[model samples]
Every structure is written in structure tokens, then in C-alpha cells.
Target: MDHAHIITELGHANITRRMLATHYAVDSEDEQLVRHIRRLLNRGDLENWKQRVHALWVTERSGVLNDAILGDVVHDEAMEVRTHAMHLLAERKDWNKTQQNWVLLALHDDHPNVQRAAANALSLHPNENHIRPLIQVRETTPDNDPQWLYGMRLALRNQLRDEDSWHSLMGYDFSEIDAERIADVAMAIPSESAGDFLVWMASKHEVKEDSLLQFFRHAARYASREQLNNLAHLVPRKFPNKSELQLELFQSVRQGLLERGEGMSPSILNWGSQMVRQIMQKNITSGETWSYHTIDGVKNTPNPWFLQVRSSADGDRDSTFICSLPAGGESYTGILRSPIFKCPEQMSFHLAGHDGYPDNPRQKKNGLRLVDSISGQVLQEAYAPRNDTAQPYTWNLLEFTGRNVFLEIIDADEGAAYAWLALGRLKPEVIPFPELSPNEEGKRLVSAAQLAGELRLNQYIPNLKEWIVGPVPDASVSIAAAKALSRLDEANLPARLSDLLQHSGKLGTAITALRKAMIAETHTTQRALLSEMVGMLPLRYQQEVMNLLSNHATSTGWLVTQIKEGRLSPLTLRNQVAYSKMESVVSGDVKILLKEWKDSLPAPNHLLQDLIERRSEGFDFQNANLTNGRALFELACSQCHQIAGEGALIGPQLDGVASRGVARLIEDILAPSRNMDPAFQVYLITMADGEVISGMPRREQGNAFVLADASGQELTVNLSNIRTRNLVSQSLMPDNFDELFDDQQFTDLVGFLLHDSSH
Candidate 1:
């Protein structure tokens, strides 16, 4: 028999009361039918069958899924039941789009678990639809809770066609294509120039470690090896045997051979041996040094462990290198490992002074001077040059045993810093760092791929127009600014979306410029887009964007109303949520609806009330007093009442107290004997296992016995999860306002809880 049949068999009696009276006995007559009864209970519509539904809801909420008939729950009119049903639905991904939208809507749900349930569902398939919302969620979210951000990033990757990179790197299965089809996919790699990447992969024991080697090695034949090599130059290679490839030797020889047309350079063979000798000699004789300026700014100490280089009165700069020996080792033979370059006089180079101190130190006083390697020009008094918060000093330790150019802090007084001193093999190229330039109008515009995509329309502005007119140029723009402009356009949208087509130019730049112009020109769709774009700006600008949108409150209000009336699309709702302007939109009955819906459905009522109240009162969650309620719960109420399976069952479980409303639960707690569970009426020998032994009082047999425990595992348990059992005078809830719950706290506490268990 299914749940319906079993419930009918149990009769209309309150099963909870009956179960309690029987000391949760396993009825032998129904024992054979228990499995069938369970099956039936598991399949019935829980919400309609109040007692069964409440039990299952509680059971599911408590993570007692085995006893909880989860499959039978359905999305229904009862907010609590539907919310719980939605949570259970998380296990089923085949839920239709309507179901999916319901889940998404639950993202704004009032119930925390309902919202969490929605989040869990979205997390399973974090793709385009979910990612944007998740991004909006990241700011207010705790840094430790990586769920929202991670889910959003995952979803964005899916939506942005980044499946290959993510799946490949994270070991996720993104595609179902077979090996032949895989080859077809391989052929579509955009950067065939990274053929060296494929070869590197082919050569790798890890990548092609198993049978996968066949695919990569075969694919390598089709790669452009030359282009791949050039690309590989940029790719970091730290393999153990990489040096054995004689890559440096091969490179030099290949260059010379190609330059001279087949005649190999003799220098190539000797180069490796000479380099090895130099490295070995350096390692044998050279020592490392550490230098730091003391915090007082009075003294510069090259610790005893480091070799000190004092500045000489002579024109030549004094340099120091120091080495400290470990406990077992007597001497430190590590090389100074200075770059092979023409050494300068009067230059104070950094030395490794101490093991823990700064490898590069900063000058306390101003007027520090160091020479620029690229220009050989004297630069004075630079700010702290290194990100070494841990060790602020001179002489950074290299990760591997390789020589590279480094910046050395010159004068402790003169903050000036100089880098590009080649300590070993690393050479500082003269290549300039790329910078974006302004147009003829002196208006800065970025013309990169990202810019092109973000601003696909509008070519009127000279700067933006020029960007569009040119063959695609790769220039950087402020990603922040581009994002800001996008939000702005979204906020001040024009009446006609087609008007956006008029501003067509190079993609991102033109679109941005056009949107800006439109926002300035009229209250057009482009203006709306720009407004919306503001919300997407960095956190630093969130308040600023909010202020800007607030300036046009009337317009925003009208737009929202129009959208709600179906005169406009719900695109505005999308924009509002994206911009996190839901607070401004929620007011009056609309506010009431948003609040009620959120409270009843997926969003937690506490969170909803918190947000609404915070927005209304102008405070953040941290500053809010919601924690007061939790504090109260921990202190007094917990003594008698159990919630979420934690507290004493000498009282009723308070976990579902949240669902029952604060006042009722409070009243019940205040007067326990008034509405005592009829089944709990019998007295029993207190068992060791928290089970209450109770039965009808019999004159002949003396006091009869019955046992009731939290778990349905009814037995004359000599041992229980709870230690001591007693008859208490007070109600299980502990209604005293002083020690247990303060008046405001009680109000807030009641507001926070409203749970029903699906047994």
C-alpha cells in the first residue's frame, strides 16, 4: 500500500499523538505492511494531508529522508509546503522550464532554504541564466561562502562558451563526443599557433600519460610547430627534464642555422658548457645577502647572516651579499647570483640580509635615487617598489635556481628604486608596456576585443567613430568604465529599442559612446541601458550608481510600473535585480507582494524582513539586530526546547516553531500543561536513553509503562541520546521574557522561525 492507503489505515487520529502514546511502538500487526505504508506515505500529497505533510516536512528539514516521503510532495498553493517541495525537487534536474523559472524566482524567495534550494538547483547547472544573478549576489555575500561567486563564475563560463577551458582544467565532463568527434573538436582550436602547446602536451607524461598520448601525438603532426614554438616561449615551462631538451642550445643553433642557411654556429655547442661552468663556479664561491632599513628609519642593518656591501667614498657604489648557515650546515655556499652585466660604481645593490626579512627594502626618507635600466636615466624617490608585505627589504629570492633581473632599493633615505639588474640569465627586454591613447578629441577610448563586444553600436563620437573605422586595433580600455556605461544605458532605456541600431560602429567602444550620448541626449532605450550598466560597476561605484538612478526616481518608478502593467517587458525587473535596486522598487502593495512572496516562498522571511527593514532603515545586515534573536535562542529557549534535533525533547522540538509562528509557539511554551500532547499524558520510568517510559496507570499492575523518544526507534531503551529525563513545571518553549527572550527579541525570533517538517 502507498502513503494514502497507510494513512487511511492509521485512521483519522492524530498519528503524532498516537505514536507518542504507544512510546513509538512498532505495531506487529502493521509490521508486515509497514514497508507498504511507508511507500504510500512517501507518495501521497503531503500538504493536503496536514499531519502526514507536517511530519514529512519536519523529517526532510531534519535530513531524515528515509522516513520523509519526498517524492509525493508537489508545488502547491501552500507557501510552506511548496517551498519544501521545491527544495526536494533539487534532486531532479529534469524539472521543466516552468519548474526552472520557479526555482529562479525562488532566488528572490523569502525563505532562506527556499532561496538556498533555488541556488542549489542553479548550482547544478550554473549556466547563462544563473550566472548574472549570481554575480550580483557576490558583493553582499561573505568571502568565505564561495558558493555564489563560484556558481556564477561557473555559469558564466558555460554561457560565454568557455566550456573547453573550464572542463579541461577542472576535470569536468563538458562534452559527450567520441574520439573521432574529439579530433573534429580539436581541429576547431582557435589558436593553432599554440601547436607548441599541443606538442608540450604530447611530451607531457601527465597530459598524454596514458592512452591519451595517441591522440595528442597524432594531432601534433598537424600542428604548425614553428608558431607553436613561438607561442611556447610565452607558456611557462617548469618541467624537471626541460633543461635536458637543450632548448637554449637548440634555439641558438636554429637561429644561426636559419640565418646563415644551413651553417650551424660553433658557439651553440660551447655555449651550454660555458654556462654550466659559470653557474657551478658562482654557486661554489658566491654568497647571498639580505638588506633592510630598520623600522625606526634610523639604522640600516645587513644582518649577520648576510654579506654587507657598504657604500664607498669612492665613485663606485658599495654592494653587499650575505649568507646564513642553517643549524646542521656550517657554511652557505649559495651564489650571489648577480646578473652578468657591466657593474656600476656608487650603486648600492640589494643583498639577502636575513632569511625572513625583506628581499627588497623601502626607503623611509624621500629623495632615494636609482637608475632606470631601459633609459639609464636617474629616477628618484620611488614608492615602495615591491608587494612584499611579509619581507620588506632588498634582494628577492628567486623561485628556482635561475638568474633574473631584479629591482634593488638604493638609498634607505631616498625611496628611489631601480630594477633590471640581471642577476643571472633573465634579461629585461626593452619592450614598452602598452597604454591606451585618447582620440583626436582627447577623449580616452579603448579599442580592444572586450571593448568591441561591449559597445557594438553607436559610431557618432569622433573618438568612438575612429575606433570603429580602423581595422581592429588591440588597445586597452578601463574595463570598469565600459561596464559603468553599459549599466547606464540599461537604466535610462529609451522608448524605442530600434533606435539603438542608429549608433552602430566598432562594437564595444561605439556602443558605449552612443549609449553615453543617448543618455545625455534623451530618455531613450540607450539611456535606460546606460542606467542599468551603472549597477554592474565595481563596488566602489555601487553607491554612486544608486545615487544616479535615484536622481531619476520618477522615471524609474514610471518604468517599473509600465513593466508591471505589461506595457513594457519584465526586462526592467531583470535590470533592477541586476542593479540590486529591488529595494527602491518594493513599496506599497507591490512592496507587500514582494515581501509576502519572498517570505512565503524560497526567500527566508528573516532575510526579506532584514533587507526591507535595512533598506528602509538604512543599514547593512551586519549592523542589523537579527543576531539578537539567535543569541536568545542559544541562551534560554535551548534549555528545554529542541530545534533541528539539538535540544531537549522534555519539551517539543522548536525547529518547526518558526513555521508555527512566534506567538503560538510562545503561548504554547508559556503554558505547556494547557495544550500538552495527549499522547505524552502517561508517566513512565525515565530511561537512560532519553526515552520517556509511559503507560496507562493500572491498579493491579501498578503504574503501567510507555516510552517516547525523538527518533521513532521505539524501544525500552536503557540508553538514550539524552542523559537525564524529568518532569518540568515550565512549558517546553520557556516563555519567560527576561532570561529566555526579550520582548523585541521575541518578536524578531518569532519573525525568523516558521518551519514545517516533511516527515
Candidate 2:
């Protein structure tokens, strides 16, 4: 490697100096090589430097490379070079007595950077010689500084190969620091004394709280009961005395025993047994009941008895024993303990307890609430007040719809010690309605009720069965009945009850409902009601109903029958031709007979229908045909572009596009703008040096300075090192919309695109 080039790339600092020192020692050559190496050392750049200096050390200066770099590396003004040099010398084989001594001297260096380097160097050949010194450093150093402790432990870790190093290191004082360090030391101290070191550390009060807890958590991973019992005396004094904690410890130990029990011998059994017993003994003594009044109230029930948790620091770690019941028989043994913490102020706390159970008796008037136990963000509130009768109480079972459920039973009285608060997952209850009968009158009435919103036609046509039966006899006898049925269909019936009876016949009421659904002017909320009502109709009737409306002409013969049957009250045979014209526009089907049918129509025909037919027949003449192309182009294509600022960049600005010519423009639209601008070309390249780079071409001299991929990130590249560069061809526009527009709309859109906004 070009050492000068590498050094220049990285910044010149003390770190680089030490690295150079180590490299020189490793690349032990003649005086000529040394002078050349010294030149690189003179310049000061080591910013983006990386990789091991092994090439210089192992190949060039292998013979002369001892730990000579240690002296300058430790005291180097640049912290980075000192760190690198120390690490370099650590693996060098000439780590003799003198070199070891030098490494130890560097351990006491004031800067943690220096100490870290020395520690790493010493750990390279970890043995018994370094343990005592490491322990000495650890004992005198402040444990709060992680670097110091980390380095000490690192140096000692590899040296702890046997019992001697392990036992020797365990005798030092590590009490004042933290649990993490204690655990680190214990882990290093032969696996045999892992339990012993933890127990001893636990016995000392000087260990920090989090550290001690962390040590137990670590020990729990490997140590068993007998090993744990060896440390039991240390645990009870440190941990808060709670039944839950005791239970958790017991369960963890039990699990550990089961997992590793086969390897355990009888000698370890006694410690395990004793630890379990002691923990269980503490649990038994921790429970105690005390009394307190609900509040200073008129009905002061002083029967409240709560378990006073004696071992915890917070006074609120108390549980009130509401009630208990037998698990298997009439004799009750199960204890019902609820967490009832005393807030700093006079405020009521919610409790979770059941009213009563067949086997487990419930505690009356229970309430429970889960608040930010730490910061007090009240999550849920639940209570069941005394319910003497089944009157609907103001209970918000589910709050905020689905987020949480609040089971509240309000007494509405001045004071209540609302008890229960058990938090679990919430499940919603869905109630299913009963099915309707098939009587025509009943079905129509039900349909009318169902369709009473916007689709009031639902009231008239209950289902396919009634629809097949045809309109009721004497349907339009009175306008009052006609309008009453209409109002019911549209959900707009008057307040009077007798008014609903006027529109009683099946078909008359059904037609009234359908009229309300199709033509009634009503509220928007009611409009959705019509769509929903339409959905309730039998699926088979939907097609028939639409067919009746669509066949406005006598084409289906149904319209003629409706007129003869007096059902076509809205239009007469002579005027129905107007609807036939709409049919021609909507459906472009023209036959020989249909052509003759159109010739007999009224002279002043609708303008739009005539245009639809004319546009349909222009395919025979030429590839291009137009009548009012400019008007068509304006209507279809002005939204997305501007040749000179009138269109949107939803596509590219096209002012200079006329230069590309119509043929290329046509190809661009047919294809798309996928080709990258030469200035904007992006490349994916991996260098021989193993650096991966990709970016847009910012500057392309001999070496390209890619601004970076627009979608990716920026990175520089020497053109020579790049392995890959290619342009991709494919427009990003969707290509499957050929059939979306009519021939005119398509033609119009294309014309507007070609004709500049300047035109």
C-alpha cells in the first residue's frame, strides 16, 4: 500500500503519528526504507483511514518488530494514533518481559484512550501475570466511567484461563463501583466461583442499585438453586420484599434446575434447597392485614382490611384483601388481594375484584383503574356499583369505541369505595337480529321499513316473490295514499300514526316506495339509505328492476305493456321516442331495421345522439378524421402540460419539444421519458478497492463526480475504478390505457399534446 497516499487521505494527527511509528517498527527495513517511512510520518492526514498495518509489520519489519512502538504510542499527542499503535503492538510476538512491563506502564495512563489501548495490548497475551495489575487498576478507579472498567475487565478476561487467575482476581475490592463490573469480574473468575463472587458482591451494600439488579439478572442465566442458595443470604436483604418477587425468583430457579438438573450432583442440592426455603419463609412473613375506613362519611364501613407490604420503600405497595373463597369446596382458601396504592394526595384508587363467583366469592362495589403507575396516565376505569335491581345504570362498557373498555357501574351517590380494576384484552359482542316472515303484506311492510331511508322502493318491493305478483288492485285511487306511501318509502312520514294505513295495498305501497327511492329529493344521509335498501332486495329482482327503468322505449315490449296496463303514467307512446334516441346514443348497435326506425322519428332530434352515431361511422374513409378537433382537443388534454408554460409537469415541460419533431414526440408518448439526461446519468459501480458507489453524473471529466442517484445517495468515483454503467430504456407511464378513452377523446388528447400552448 502507498503509505503516503493513505496517510494523506486520513488527517495528520497524533493517532496517525503513532500508527506511523508502529508501521515503521513493523516494516523493519534498511535505513533507506526507514527514511522513506519517516517522510509519510512527517505529513499529518489520517481522517478516513482504515485497515490493519499488518502488511508493513509482518512483511517488511517482521524481524525488528518488538513492542518498541509502545513508548511513543502511549504518550502520542494524537489519541487515534496512540490507540492504533497499542493495538498493533499487542499481537506482535515479541511480547517479552520488557514489553509486558511497558504495556503495564501504559495502563495507568491518564487518558481513557491510552488505557483502553494498553488494556487491549495486555489482553493480547492474557495470562496470570496481568490479573493482579488489572485488579489493582479496577480497585482504585471510579466505576462510573465505563471505559476504565471496560478496559480492566478486557485485560483480565483472557488471563482468567485457569483457577489461579480466577481465584486471585476475586480477592480484590470491587464493592464501591456497580453491578455490571461485578458481574464482569465474576464471569472472568473461573466459572466455578461465578456464584461465589456474585454472592459476595451482593452481601456488600456499596454496589449500585441498577448494577446489583443487573448482576442478579445475569447470574440467573447460568447459576442454579444450590449455587443460588449459596447466595440467598445476599438476595433477601437487597430486593424489595414482595410475594410476587419471591415467586418470580422461585420460578426462575425452578426452571433453571429443570433445564440443568442432570449435570448437578448431590453436593449442590443442599444450597439449592436452603435458598428456596429461605425465600419461601420471607414470602410467608410478608403478608399482613390492616383496617381503614372507606372515607370520613355517614355510612363509614371500617371493615376494610389490606395486606401491608413491609419490605418495599413505597408505602403504596399494599394490597387490600377484599374477600376469599374455597377453590374446591365450601371452605375458602384463595386470597383475593387487590392493589390499592395510596396517592400522595387524597384521591380514590380503583381496585379490580369480582362481585362474587360460585367457588370464589366476589367483593361488592368493586372498581379498578390502570393509570400511569409511574407517570399517572390513567389508561382505563372500571367499576361495578351495588346493583339491587336490573335497572339500566350509566355504565360505559367500551370507551373510545374500540381502544379500551371501561366497565363502570354508577351509584350516583356522594361517596363510594368502588372496588374492581382487572385489565385484560377487550372483545366486542355482536348481536344478530331475528329473520323476517314471508307474508306479502308483512314482507312489503318489512321492506318498506327497511327501505324507509333513500331507497324507499324497498318498501314497495319486499323481494322477488312479491314483485312477481304484480301491482296491487286499484293502486292509485287517492293522491293522499299515493303521497303517504311515497313519504314512508323516503323515510319522511308525518308524525300521525293513522296516516300510514292510507297506503295499505301491496303494489301501490311498493310503487310509492320505489318512486321515493328513485326520484325523491331528500337529505344526503338518506341517500346512502337508498343504496343500502337496494342491497336488501333479493339479488334476482335487481336486474329486473333496472331493466324496467332502462327499457324506456317499446323495444322490450314491457314499456308498451306498462302503458296499456296504466303503469306508464310518466310518458306516453308518442313521446317515448325521445328515450329511444338516448338508447341509440348509449348503445352504438345499429341494424338494418334500426336504421329505418330512426328515419321515422320526429324532425328536431336531440343534437348529442346524432353526433354519437356520426362519429361511429367514420372508420372507412381515412386513418384520420375530425369535425371539431380544436374544441375536442381543448376539452380532453389541457390538464397535464404546456409547450410554453400552459401544461403541468405531471409530464415534462414541452416548449423545446418541436425541435425533436412529430415522429419522435409520437414515439415519446407511445413510449415514455425513461432515458436519463446525459448530465443526469446514474451508475451502479463497485471498485476493485471493494468500495460500492452509485450516484448521478455531476461532473464527467477523466473521473466522474456523480452528484448521486436522485433516488439514492451521493458518492464520488474515479472513472477508472467503476465496474458498471448502462442506460435503462422504458417510459414510466402506464401503457395499458389504450381502451380507456373513445377514439375522439384519444385523438383530441394527442392534438393538444402536439399543439404548443403558444399556439
Candidate 1: regions farther than 4 A off = 1-86, 109-114, 125-128, 138-140, 147-759
lDDT of 2 by residue, 140-187 (tens): 666787876677787777676455665665456544454435466665
Candidate 2 lDDT (Cα, 0 to 1): 0.39
- Strongest candidate by lDDT: 2
What's the CA error at residue 141 for candidate 2, in Å? 4.9
lDDT: worst 10-residue window of model 2: 429-438
lDDT of 1: 0.35
For model 2 the local lDDT of residue 137 reads: 77
What's model 2's TM-score?
A: 0.33
Question: TM-score for all predictions?
Answer: 0.22, 0.33
- The candidate that wins on TM-score is 2
- Cα RMSD of all models vs. native, in order, equals 35.6, 27.3
